[model samples]
Target: MPTEYVKRVLAACVITVLSISNTANGLAGDTKEYRIGLTSVIFADGTAFVNDWRTYLTHHLQAPVKFVQRQTYREVTDLLLAGDLDAAWLCGYLYLQHRDELELLNVPLFKGKPLYHSYLIVPSSDTKTRKLTDLKKKVFAYSDPDSHSGYRYPQLSLISAGIEPKHFFAKTFFTWSHRDVVNAVADGVAQGGAVDSYVWETLAEKDPQLSRRTRVVSKSPEYGFPPLVTQRGLAQRRADNLREALMHMSSDDMGSKVLQILNLDGFTVGNDDLYNNIADSIRIVEQGG
Candidate 1:
């Protein structure tokens, strides 16, 4: 064979092998089961919620899907970063902190908006506490320390008011979950608590008795809601598949039903810039101002 022709033939063979390898990898991704991590959220039971999410993803992706529940957002993030979880639903605070290490998958839309707030809640019967300042020198409950709406934003709100949570509150503790924060405030275990507004509203809609026991004393400005994220080096084909299934979850009957149960409008593509404000808040809090 001519030297030029031989070189062309070898290049073509190399391209063909690469193409075949890519296709095989895609096929493997399509058949591979995934384990997803979920942070604690309100539900009748964690097991039931996990099963529901598993059913939704398994049906939508047309593959086996398993969900692992973590008691705290930090645990979920740790599992995801350590490669124990294929993906996770993590709070925006943690997402921003580790944004460079992960890829944004989807952000859940609630009531047509992709943002939510942190609410400072006090017992309905407590007339003395009207705002965050009113809770001064009183026991305060915070959700996970890594939670945006639970801890970061609320701390910023208190800082903005010229009071540091640690100094202003008689004592502080973390409830680990927004629902637990609500329960603590309702049961008067804490004089006031900070919680995700979305979780509080969902509880209000589904379990009014628990919600009605508390009143919102203040609300932080809207912040990006928590998002589903995967490791940065995840297989592109697998990430694309999961993103597609989640973004279109509300367009079909089963998906729509699941959305209803989860109190979500649907999922949509997210941008890292959406959480920049959370980062700004973090900076302010960490600087003690």
Candidate 2:
């Protein structure tokens, strides 16, 4: 069963939190909440799943923590860049795009793997489209324009097949979240969609009825999972505290429970080199090779 605490923060609250000034510090010696930016990539409906994270971090950092939710990865990245957030969990694509201005905090370890894939999914009843090429001239969904799995890697697959996404699909739309992409394909709103494979699999376990309606037609090569990052100039002491909290999350009872809810083993320090594959993929897609 999903944790009961997951129902605490409704989507409206998340949006309201994002609209405020969430700076981590306000005047010296004054207690302030550490604002963490989260995009819809992982939590599309609400912020309940990460309620425990807030509790754990508050206890460890000895400061209040507020989760600032955004509708897209780009928005979260922008918040972090503008110093409105102390840290953010963002897609690997956006991390690489702004690596020069950000500092990697940690990368999640899922089932012992630091790598993840992008799934090209189609409706289960669609026998005509067994592979990506078969979906040519068909309506498709992409999670976000800046998403590596949703856009870049999928576009690379098309380039590999001697096709360009713009000229290949009958229609293409951004759903802004992997779950939305899955639903779009399952409901026949889109013939196919590209999504984070981890999100697809998680939904398969949590909502089989919705997930079962779609099938993965292809899987992109594994790349670094999305990472938690902070602005480069964030206070070293605070950054270390946040990193320590995440890395040791599996050691304590509350933290362990949060890790389990997130379907992650724990967090580990990650290097920028881990995302070179995404960088190379972006280059190929941009050069239209």
Candidate 3:
């Protein structure tokens, strides 16, 4: 063969091999699923909403997205710690417990802020109850044991008021879902409940009947909203990509719709300081301060 003809053949063969290698790598990346664990406390009331949000994330991340949900925060936390999940949306109290093991990705914004509060709620019929102290010896419902808004804040609030948290309520139970906490109180199963203010406001907006049946006795001081987090040791590049997807979600049309369903304004690269108050509450609960 002529010299130029031989060189052309070699060049074509080289291009073919490079193309094959790139295609294989792309397939590998596409097949790797990013699992995200979501606790029930963060559950949006509608399943359709979750599915849409998952689809949006999958598109933006350019990978399959799996949302793993469990009955309790601890179950999801365990899965995340064991590497069953790549990331999770967890209660701040749970995040604080495993802060060293988890990487904070971003915090969802509610009403344009990275902060939310714990709401002390009671049946609308109970007008006499003014605060946690006033509910002494009354039954109480908590959304989850590991919940910052649903459990820890109430515990800390009672402790701060010089009341024995353990003995203050005649009975206490876990409703598991913030919506259920509202339901439990509305149905008179419990005289009062601690719930995420974000959940409460969302419910109040979409289902006025439920919100009308219950009343907010008080709202706890603002705490960092429950956050999206990844494994502590996830590759920096992968983590950054996931973080970028979330923080920029609001800019996408589908992403913005999902945020509306979630009753959130958007997301931001929240700071460690937003959760400092929660860490303090956790320490007090553990150390009996």
Candidate 4:
């Protein structure tokens, strides 16, 4: 074969391999099923939520939505970034870390507000300790290293007070969920932990069971709220359709029920401005100070 022809053939082969890899990895369109994978925080359990949201979305889109459940924030983020998942309900910090690879589709309007905050939780007995600095050298429980309210804000609070998480705590552990972190502290698994203040409030207000065990220690400064995100390069029309479904669906009684379960009043259009601080926090963690 001629050298020029050989070069052209090699480039074509490389492109073919990449296309096949992406398809095999769940990137390519297959059978036109409009599947939506939700990250953690959208569900308290597995089955009921997928059924509820799918009913809402598929009714509007006029297609069946296979609700795929992802176990953690990281897993959802990876799937969304890789184009394996069509959409995700994601926290601000996760979106911040991967915003370049994703687009904000919609944000949930929780309790008639679009923003939420974090809480520092110590035992109810530790009333005198009021600030981040006061808890140094204490055992701490974080839900996950990648969690926004559960890890990022608490870590950033410590760094702002001139303490690094690895150096500040006597020990650290992951409980994998906001409720678990709250339970760990109340159960004395650790001296304290951080959790979503919204979860704390919602559980306290709605679940008398969880409220009996825990109380808030302090509240972190508010940052951008969590959002619904779609993979970058998702078709613009599809993104618009999904956003319209969310924003306009809250007109009837059934729509209200879905919003109630999510602790949301409705859905709203949002942009990237709300998450800039989260990106700053990520940079702090990466720089180790």
Q: TM-score: which candidate is best?
A: 3
lDDT by candidate, in order shown:
0.84, 0.85, 0.88, 0.77
Those runs of model 1 whose alpha carbons end farther than 4 Å from true positions after fitting are 1-29, 41-45
Compute each candidate's TM-score over C-alphas: 0.87, 0.87, 0.89, 0.84
lDDT of 3 at 96: 81
Q: Report the poorest 10 consecutive residues by lDDT, candidate 1.
A: 40-49
TM match of model 1 to true structure: 0.87
- Considering lDDT, which of the candidate structures 2 and 4 is the better prediction for this target? 2
For model 4 the local lDDT of residue 189 reads: 82
Report clash pairs, candidate 2.
none
**Residue 48 of model 1, lDDT score:** 62
For 165-276, candidate 4 gives per-residue lDDT tens digits of 7788898998878878878887878888888876777777677575566657788767666898998888776787778888976885666777777677888898787777
Q: State the TM-score for model 3.
A: 0.89
Over the stretch 178-242, how does candidate 2's per-residue lDDT look in tens digits?
A: 99999999999999999998789888878899999999888988999889999998988788888
* Number of backbone-clashing residue pairs for each candidate, in the order shown: 0, 0, 0, 0
Misplaced by over 4 Å in model 3 are 1-31, 43-45
Ranking by TM-score: 3, 2, 1, 4
Candidate 3 or 2, higher TM-score:
3
Q: What C-alpha root-mean-square deviation, in Å, does candidate 1 show against the real structure? A: 10.2
